[model samples]
Target: MEIGEDYRDAVLPQSRWEKRKFVRCDFTEADLRGLVTQGCTFEECDFTRTDLGESKHDSTAFRSCVFDRTVLAEITWTGCSLLGSSFVDCRLRKIKVRETDFTLVSLGRADLRQCELSGLRFREANLVEANLSGARLRDTDLRAARLLGTDLSETDLRGAKLDADALVQAKFTGARVDLDTAIAFAAAHGLIISS
Candidate 1:
């Protein structure tokens, strides 16, 4: 069912939003925990500071959405599309984002610790100052992605594809990688890894 086409601060929680559509809606500070949605669409929506933890979403599409400081911990989002979305200072720990498209998304200062983001595409996305410590990014593509001041300490980067320029510009202090990846990164910086 479609509701709140252009409303602000609407409280919609613990409801099933199957095949629903929301346009220019604002759910700021709303408690949406344990919400279930499937094939839902949100355009230019604002979910700033919303409590969306433990929510389950499948095939949901969001275009130009803002989730600034939203609590999305333990959320399950599968087959979702978040194009041009911004998630500033949001809590994203333990969130499952499988088969999702986050093209051009901005995750400025988001908490993504311990999240498993394997094989995900982060082309041109911004993750500045975000906490990715202990996160598993195996085979994740970070081409042209901005990771300046990103906290990748102790994070696993096995098979993660990074752009030469972006990787050099990012901060990976104390981050962990396999020997092959380490050698590759060293070679990119004109350093020879001699045995």
Candidate 2:
């Protein structure tokens, strides 16, 4: 379904509705805070600069949605499906995403500092230029995910399976790593250190 032509300045309310279906709608610069949007379906919608703070989104499906500059601080997402979704330049600090399916999602230039994302499967996802400093990533599968200019400083990657190609342009300064991986990283990146 094609979206409305003047959907940028449109303001939709979700105070009464629990499970709202937003299909092909544009929510640019909209305020959607303190709402319970459980099990909502948002397909092909543009959520640019929208505020979704303190919202309860459990088991929500957001496919092919563009979340450019979206303010998603202090949101709790549990059992959500975000396949093929793009969140460019979004603020996502202090968010907890438990048991979420984020396959093939792109989160470029997003600030996810100090977020908790344990055991999340992000296969083939693009996390380019994303700030993931001090985040929890224990046993997470980051296979085939892009790390172009991504800041992973102080991130926990214990037992996290990641391919070597995914470490391209990933900054892990002061991060915790094993001995074997540290040697391999220094060798692969061509560094000259003292003993």
User: Candidate 1 residues 1-195, lDDT tens each?
Assistant: 344454445577787888988888878888888999999999888998989999999999988999988899899989898989998878787899888877789987888888988778888889888888888888787878888888887787888877766556666777777776677778878896667
Model number with the top TM-score: 1
The total of clashing pairs for model 1 equals 0
**Candidate models: Cα lDDT each:** 0.82, 0.79
lDDT of 1 at 120: 83
TM-score of 2: 0.82
Worst 10 residues of 2 by lDDT: 1-10
TM-scores of all candidate predictions against the true structure: 0.88, 0.82
> What's the TM for model 1?
0.88
Each prediction's total of clashing residue pairs, residues at least 3 apart in sequence or on different chains, is 0, 0
